[model samples]
Target: MINVNEVVETNEMIEKENLDVRTITLGISLLDCISSDLEQLNKNIYNKIYEAAKDLVATGEQISREFGIPIVNKRISVTPIALIGGAACRTKEDFASIAQTLDKVAKAVGVNFIGGYSALVSKGMTPADKLLIESIPLALSTTDVVCSSINVGSTKTGINMDAVRLMGTIVKETAEATKENDSLGCAKLVVFCNAPDDNPFMAGAFHGVTEADKIINVGVSGPGVVKTALEKVRGESFEILCETIKKTAFKVTRVGQLVAREASERLGVPFGIIDLSLAPTPAIGDSVADILHEIGVEHAGAPGTTAALALLNDQVKKGGVMASSYVGGLSGAFIPVSEDQGMINAVEAGALTLEKLEAMTCVCSVGLDMIAIPGDTRDTTIAGIIADEMAIGMINQKTTAVRLIPVIGKGVGETVEFGGLLGYAPIMPVNQFSCDAFVDRGGRIPAPVHSFKN
Candidate 1:
């Protein structure tokens, strides 16, 4: 199984092709830490995460150094706080206190971010879920590393229009609360339809109630690697092009498999899954859009872009599954606007727009991610957008999420900088058409007829 040529090829991918393990996330369940007493609950949550994740960052660094593979981030995801704090959290402030505790543990352990400040309200909201939902603005504004998500729709359960409407207002409040940071708080809050439990990516990762106590999941990314391989087969037949991508993806996923096994064995935690997603960064040559360009699209949102994405997404899963038995999470291509420079370029070139991006999400890994919209855009408009995306997921039975930032006091044609992994974005315009009457009809959108398959 070992060969010098293979080893050298791997090295080339790492050194020049932007191939790396994106994250090693530790999923720790907080169910056992729940208590009827507020103080005791916070203390228990803090101690549990601290003991479980203290060595995560150091372990990731050790693996990267020894293997000569770059591990970008160490993260932690806990069981949704809404479930863990149900008994003790009486008000929004109580839920926010839990977020503070989570932020404290994340800082102590030195991880980049900690997720699971979330509530699952796909069909209806519990009292605790409502509290957690209402508290997201305060919780995200006050905490540095805590990320939040709300699942407002799912295939099994219909979309909760009430939650969708509430989230629109909450998104606006979150932007206002962090206007000094270019509404960065909204960047950390994702609203999802069919959200996965074991996602290793931030702003959406959370340990589902069904998972083990603690486990290690790894996310791998290699857009440049894929693009480089595709270039070798330029102007080739569709069959040859697809074969090239599958082979390249298999190689990239094997790297993630090795890292996941090593980290799990060393940390004494069970390995969860290998998330072989083509997660791009602000860095050049590391964009999923670039891979699309190599596939024949002039720009990410141009004609045939969705078809190109669907092909890439299918082949990635095909190749990834062959490499690792436990390939899960959002293991495909991510199309975040701010995180991918090519997508930003497409927007500036007028080849991409919010409408085109939404159309693309029907085929990509996630939906409308890291997009900056005008602050004056009505909350009802945001809800309408979320509803449309959620409807896509519910009908198609796939995962779709929205991470939109309504940059306060910013309008279309302006730009806002959200430094680091979240790069700068030009403010995109939204339709001024009124959706108030539509959003005002607050009731659940019943699941599609296909959902009744029993």
Candidate 2:
């Protein structure tokens, strides 16, 4: 056990570096479970996931208790359902049923969420893709832990307008179906460009084609630890601050690597990537917004937030890469609007706006996650937000996503409760400009020019 002096040192390092363990995800590939018979396929999937992750939650809890640090989330990601059910299901019902089975396995194992009820429709939709999209609302509404995503854009294939349009309707439907929770179900759906296959994060985590049959990925988070550490080191020079942050990130990511190794070894699964995204929680100490405030922003989403995030991202990636050779996913800061209490407070106080958040995404890991908008938000406006994020990812050749909630009957400044994990968000307003012209030019935007350097 670490002594009080060591604990003080750890806290100092955490505050100075803005470092914490974000999440630890177990990836279970379901391709082998695919069968012509729908029931057989579902059964195979359930057995595979259940067998692979039965001890995941228990293992995580044990590690957290032993380490004396919090492991924020324990999650599972599986092979994209579109491909897994391609040979079995001919209709949307099959997709819904498959998602239901996945959700059941997740709950049974005590995991917070199960991702990969999703599709990669960047170029075009397969028969299975269409069905998967259609069944997403039903799947998410009925299941407590199921999350979905659609990859409609990539640097190689550009953005698929048709698929994007379909997702707009899907998001609206998902929100309306879960209207009692202020469109919380839609908060669990993300649209991504350059989505990672081995991501251990929620709403957008799915095992890609390149992934092995089964693997363990860890995302470590400790915003509270980071915040506490930052408070200790007052009036440091910028270079000193950067060095401090890098060292702190190194320690946090090392802890993540340790947990990942133990979990993978015990589970008899191949070790996957460690995503170093600084995911926030709703607690007071566990906040990315508080980190910003500690960094002299005084308020999150303020003028200095973007520059601060840029520095934070660079320092985190440098430290995480040094800590683990297997680092992947969006390995930087996450500024999800609803999940962090500071962010919700800022939105409610009108200190954070959509435009400022967009700028922050340029420097953060993902874009516009869990943002709540007025109930009357136009579909075109939602599409515009997604388009902006995809464009950023395509041009920069990085992964970015948007998961915005259009709360029913809630306008700007109103609050919506999404219960545990999803949290609550204050409704934000969007620009009222007509994006119909841009959205109507609905052909596939070709891959970026710089994508062919190889």
lDDT of each candidate versus the true structure = 0.95, 0.84
Which residue pairs collide in model 2, if any?
15-229, 15-230, 17-245, 20-222, 21-220, 21-221, 22-220, 22-221, 23-219, 23-220
Residue range 1-454, candidate 1, lDDT tens digits: 9699999999999999999999999999999998999999999999999999999999999999999999999999999999999999998999999999999999999999999999999989999999999999999999999999999999999899999999999999999999988899999999999999999999899999989999999999999999999999999999998899899999999999999999999999999999999999999999999989999999988898999999999899889999999998999999999999999999998999999999999988889999999998788999999999999999999999999999999999999998988888989989898999999999999999999999
Cα displacement (angstroms), candidate 2, residue 69, comes to 3.5
Cα TM-score per model = 0.99, 0.94
Candidate 2 wrong stretches, greater than 4 Å: 1-22
By summed lDDT, the worst window of 10 consecutive residues in model 1 runs over 422-431
Model 2 lowest lDDT segment of ten = 13-22
Full-model lDDT, candidate 1? 0.95
lDDT of 2 by residue, 1-454 (tens): 6579967766564555434455678888888898999999999999999998899888888877776556767899998999999898887777889989998999999988999999999999988898899998888888878999999999988999888777877888888889987777897899999898888898899988899888889998766655665676757776866776687678778888888888788778899999887888776677889878888886887789899888878887887799898999878888998899999888877789999998888878988899989888888778877888888888889888999899888897678877776678888889999887887788898898998878
